[model samples]
Target chain A: MSDILPPGSVIGILGGGQLGRMLSVAAARLGYLTHIYEPAANPPAGHVADRVTTASYEDADSLRAFAASVDVITYEFENVPTAALDLLEAAKPIRPNRRALAVSQDRIAEKDFLTGLGLTCAPYAAVSDMDSLQAAIAQVGTPAILKTTRLGYDGKGQARLRSADDAGAALADMNGAPAVLEGFISFTHEVSVIAARGLDGAVSCYDPGENVHKDGILHTTTLPANLSLAQRTDAVLLAARILNALDYVGVMGVELFVTPKGLIVNEIAPRVHNSGHWTQNGCAVDQFEQHIRAVAGWPLGDGSRHSDVVMENLIGDDILRVPQIATEKHAALHLYGKHEARPGRKMGHVNRVTPK
Target chain B: MSDILPPGSVIGILGGGQLGRMLSVAAARLGYLTHIYEPAANPPAGHVADRVTTASYEDADSLRAFAASVDVITYEFENVPTAALDLLEAAKPIRPNRRALAVSQDRIAEKDFLTGLGLTCAPYAAVSDMDSLQAAIAQVGTPAILKTTRLGYDGKGQARLRSADDAGAALADMNGAPAVLEGFISFTHEVSVIAARGLDGAVSCYDPGENVHKDGILHTTTLPANLSLAQRTDAVLLAARILNALDYVGVMGVELFVTPKGLIVNEIAPRVHNSGHWTQNGCAVDQFEQHIRAVAGWPLGDGSRHSDVVMENLIGDDILRVPQIATEKHAALHLYGKHEARPGRKMGHVNRVTPK
Candidate 1:
């Protein structure tokens, strides 16, 4: 455990996207200032953060300065450059450590780490080249997903194969990048558990939320996910086990596939996740603040939901519905402060409070 | 109603206090940028606002630049200089209007405005000098309060008169400033209705919260106030009437004295009030966000309370308990980011969720 941050301490966030923007807001509420470091100009988080350094990840000098200026450091995205982390970790403490990022950065490593902890993930094999890809496809069987081992998100950098005949096309889609052949897991639905581990190693997880996808992107997360009492206990326990394994301190989103036998791990986000946005309205302490508390060495807040919530992401043209959503009863709207609403860009989200 | 402020438009705020700090956070969530104009250096709102102009209100050049940069203007305090407002109103629209400020600025005007609207307020008489003070006190009777007409806040610039003999001492305490003598009202408890009036004239009011004061300062505000259904309706109706009478387009906190006969108006603040802080934990749309929505010309959101909350102000040494409060379940802490916590200064507040 590191020194507990007082109200005036600064929290440095690496990526200045919507997640960072929200984390900055949460930090400000807790009396901590956030300094944002991003490659892009006018990032959403920069609008709320106390300071911003607009420089590429390759810029070691700027990274050094950003790290020196902050008391504790955390990143919003998984794919942060290793060189930048080396600079940051030298001057400031980075919560969740670099190992979680290393595992989540690659599909093969994430699956290996989860399975190593006695957790069930989709059966997968490493794919190197065309020949190796073909061999891995044979072992993983048909109806598999060929995903780039690194830097892939929101269904990008991947291809789906329905049968053995489609292996060649899927292999070509990898573009010579290290890939993983994962056998598809037939499941009833997708649910996520947003779990937080404090500096003291105590863990707390919100109730799992069922998720729906549209065009391979998260569309909505409905709270009070359909789960038997046994499954709910299993979900929370596995999430805690993973955090303890990593010696992690921060909120991590664990996506799971509910199956007849048990729940299978999909992936984990090292920071606050989109699915957990419902906590902003449904719970006393939300995921953003939960992450801040964990990293700041403060005790984790109660991660209990008081009301049922349905959180819908506003992507691209979805922003046009702001006026209408403004009039909706019990609707809490949060925008990312992005100037241009590009297609597939997460503009904001609306959380609707439903009857418990 | 003026043209609606689009998501990216800038909202100018006059006073950069804690109220402005919360308002800036709410505006950012709604995708609007805020530019804070405050006389103080390094204000709490400036930490979150997109831009901050630190100059005295008398600085015409700075005020001009601030007005030019924002699309519309609003203020967090009622004591804004009339000359500064004259310059600002010429360039941009000020929601809640100058009339609201004028009415709330002077004790005599505030009382007269309420009485003219058929809203029952304690009887008050204007007093300019010693003769006028003696005459007004004779008419309003003993056990009255003598208050300065303007520039008074937080129980400052006022004296209580309990008897005819106490009139001379109370008048002397006024220091020859224009004053008003208000007759005392016997009430069981103090309750305030945090209400919002949108540009479309539609009004919404949150459930009244009972307030407790210590040393002439607000201590805590508990929701689900002890009031009958009829009293609750009357409170909301009277708040709406006051907003309509002022032609207001923003949030207003109306303090009421619940007496045997009816509710008597104590005062009204034409901005987010400290007593309404519980809404941050109890409602999806809080007073700060409600004021932002009303001033931005957006439709009003539901002001219904979801959880019963007790809001406690952390004044001065009260902030030392933050460490313990952080560990408490269902506690939402909002700090003003004041570097120094002097006695009587509000350092932060804690909103605790309690069973209804």
Candidate 2:
């Protein structure tokens, strides 16, 4: 790729979800143009982007056209098909690389990559067949999870293996697709470190945020996540180490479990994550903007927080309460332009800032 | 008019300037779509809006189509042609109403309306001919200004009369258009109150900002304008009174001259003003979002300030210094995506915030 793309260069976004919407806003704020390529008609990101191309991701013709129009391509979700990535890579530079995407696309590869970096992870083994499932269960013991290694988000594509007997049916239900069996850890809390790595190899991480999930979806995130200064420093260093090892050139979110021993790696998302939304109201620059800067080859902003912040997601019909939230003196409300209030769908988020 | 327009409802914007661009961002934040209609092909607001229609205000067919595509219409600049407004008003609601626009579109009418409400203004008289100009000059005396009554802004279409003998040439230069001759007020400082009036009759104002102008364009605005407690209260009260009188349903900027006697009304913009740019970083709800809320029939946001702020305009080549300005811990940089940085053009703004 060229040394650095200018500010006016167009950045192509793959998925038109809320993350894409915010990324477009951030990109525009930095004097960069965004062109959204999403298969779905009327994707939310199209509202603020410079242009929108509505076509199926697997349509090679459309993908090529979209790729030709942009200087670099990035995606909001990790589940993009490898074939789609191949087509885009042939046309323009793709950041975070296809290798990072492949490593993060499945649970097994992700865990192995982290473990290879001398990072702690929950004990896990891959299961390809029923016999292998039983062997994996024997190795990791019962009371583990059997999760499909691909196309899973929130709580989908996973089942709990209460006992060894349930492993056979779980594997059968998987239909012989690759899966991972992992032992559950008793984590005190869940936290995530959102960090960005520039093309020039500079990395910076925001303060870790303690996250709470309801039904496998993030409910809220509170910053200064009650960690010791040592723990916080360790979490940031771990995230930076992962970004460097991967040669990542954009924002990466690393989810960690605070166990009795220390922080254990849970998963890594190669895009802006929901846990860092508080930065929109509390910090000088937000995660989305930081990601744009990193991808656009600009200098990273000081990701320092001006205040303590709490971000609460407005899921489904929870958006109707925005009026009450808007009345707060320190609250900043952001609502996505989703027409349907479908259950479990993220509708918006609100950030409340308190002076440090 | 409907109490609430749905998410996909198109909002027609009258003038495609920087205020319109910021308003489009705010509208997109609320999930309402924006359609920009401007005579200029490459309007600033068009860069980010969903659609752009380039046609003259006199083109009824284009105006009809633009009005028909959107549920409601609003303006960025106050000097919208009355005929175009009539066409738009025939189709949908024109917010802040044409009456406020009419009052503000003319300098003499604005002063008369404010003074009719028992408010103080510099002495002024209408001049339609050379005789009237001489008589008005005799009354207001020298060192006053002779300004065309219509379609004037940012120190344009106005000439300073240094002596009584220059009144005839000034009036002749007006080219038979209606004009206003106003007595000059020696002021210690110039300040403005950015206030919003909700559809439900709620009025809220940010703290008045002391302004400094250079070369007929605003250079900087500093909040907490060295005003005493009584003066601040009076400024807020004046803004509220103007909103109530106009029955305004959006953000209106009231500029005042801080004279020896008291605060005198200078002019009013029936739309968001440049003076409120500080709110984008200093207040909980910025003027753009406040204007959006007022027009959408939503409850007004808390306009409380979190910090003392100074906002500097980045005109023309000043935008090239964004990188240097971005390094400041307290400065938030905002750039308008205008493709060309012409001389004296408002390219962007930066706000420096400090704790009150």
Candidate 3:
């Protein structure tokens, strides 16, 4: 067992987007100072963090000083450069570990790890070149998704293979980068369970949230997903299996395709998930605070939902509706403080609470 | 009546205590930037705010600069110097207004104002000097408390005159400062109502929280206080009446003594009260966020409680229980991140939720 850091200890966060911003806020609530190490200028997380180091991941001196200043380090995203982790891990412990990052950073490796645990996932094959793409298509078949193995999110670095004839086109989309071809899922709906694994190895999973995506961007997440009690229990157990398998030390978003046969794992995010944002207004212990508690080695809090909430993403022009949403009695507006509201950018979200 | 400031506008907070710190966090949630103007170095609020100006309130140049930088100003306390308000009000609007500060700054004026509004309070008389103190004591009778008219809080500047013989010594305890003698109220318990008003004259009030004080310092605030439906209705009405009377644009905490016959207004704080901290875990929109929304000219959110909560202050060494409390299910720790834990200092608080 490791010594739990009391108040006044600094937590180093590797990303400065909205997820990191919220994590810093949660850390501060628990009496911990946050040092945000983000390469981007004027990061949203820096607005609430105690200190912000503006330097690239390649800046070894800056990374070293940041690591030295903090008692523990955690990243808001899985794509943190391995080199930066190499520098920071030598100075301080990184929660969630590099093994989880390595598996998540590669599609083929992630599927292999999941299958090794006897978990069900979509059919996928490694596509290294045109020949591999053709071979993988012959196995996984058409109506699949071709995606880069690393550094892709929000539907980026991906192409859809509608038919066998589109194989060459999909290969062209990869541009020689290592890619993944996943067979299309005939899921009734998509759901995600946000699970946290404590340093003590205790796992807690929040109720799954049913998600709706528009143009591959999350549109809304409705709580109490239309699933039977048995499905809910199965989803949670599968999520815990993933967390335990990874030896995860923080919150993980496990996206699943709910089908007639059972639940099929879609993808996993090593940080707070956008689909779980409804917990901010629906549960007493939110995902952000849960993540902070897990990273800080504190006990996992109650993740039970107190209120039914429907969360809607405020993307680009959706912000214009804030004037109306702000007046809605049960709607809690959560803005990210982002200056520009460009299309597809997650400016903020509003959680509308409904009485149970 | 006025335009609500957009999200990115800066909010200037006047105090640097835990209240300000929580306020800054709340402002950030609403997508507003906070700039803390505190006289003390490394103020708790500064750790979360986007900017901090550490200069004495008496410093005219710093005060001017702080006011100019923010779109609107609101304070975390009622005792701001009149001269400072005079300078800041010329640059930007200070919420809760000067009338609130003037009335709350002087105990005599506060009592007069409350009585003028036909509110019932304990028998009291102002003591300008020793002769007046003697006369006030004779009128208010024995077992009365003598408190300084200005700069008194948390049982700090008050002395209990238990008997007639203790009058001279109690008067001497005032140290020649103006004071008030009040006949102690015989009440079953103390409850406080946190109410807010908006720019368009809208009002919202949270349920009353019953408070217990130890050594005149707040010990705990238990929600769903033992009160008849009529008493609850009266509490909300009285609180709304006070807000409407002041044309208040922020949250106010109204403390009342529950007597056998009816409720008697004890005193009021022009800002968020310690008694209302339970809202952090009990309600969807907490007192801090309510204050921010009102000051920002945004529409008020629902202030209804979602769960029963008991909030206990982590004063001084009480923080030592944080490790144990962190493991307690449904207990949410909210620490101020103060560097030192001095005696009687409010280091943080724990909001224990009762799953009703």
TM-score of chain A of each: 0.98, 0.97, 0.98
Docking class of 2: acceptable
> Which portions of model 1 show Cα errors greater than 4 Å?
none
lDDT of 3 by residue, A89-152 (tens): 9999999889989999888889999899898999999989888888899999989999999888
lDDT, candidate 3, B161-205, per-residue tens: 888788788888889899999998799999999999988789999
Q: For residues A1-356, write the lDDT of model 2, one tens digit per residue.
A: 24557656899999999899999888877777889999899888888888999998789999999999999999899998889999999989888778789999999999999999999999999999987888898899879999899988888888889999787778877777899999988899999999999878889898899999998899999987978888899899999989999999899989999987999999999999999998887676789988988888777777877778899999998977776786677888887788888999999998887776
Could you tell me the lDDT of residue B135 within candidate 2?
89
Which portion of correct inter-chain contacts appears in model 1? 0.61
What TM-scores do the predictions have? 0.98, 0.96, 0.98
Worst 10 residues of 2 chain B by lDDT: B1-10
Error of 3 at A213 (Å): 1.1
Worst 10 residues of 1 chain A by lDDT: A1-10
What are the candidates' individual DockQ scores?
A: 0.64, 0.48, 0.68
On lDDT, the leading prediction is 1
Error of 1 at A118 (Å): 0.3
Alpha-carbon shift of residue A34 in model 2 (angstroms): 1.3
Candidate 3 or 1, higher DockQ:
3
Regions more than 4 Å wrong, model 2: A1-4
Where does the lowest 10-residue lDDT sum fall in candidate 3 chain A?
Answer: A1-10
Query: Worst lDDT window (10 residues) for model 2 chain A?
Result: A1-10
Each prediction's number of clashing residue pairs: 0, 0, 0
TM-score of 3: 0.98
Q: For each prediction, how big is the interface RMSD?
A: 1.9, 2.8, 1.7
Clashes of 3: 0
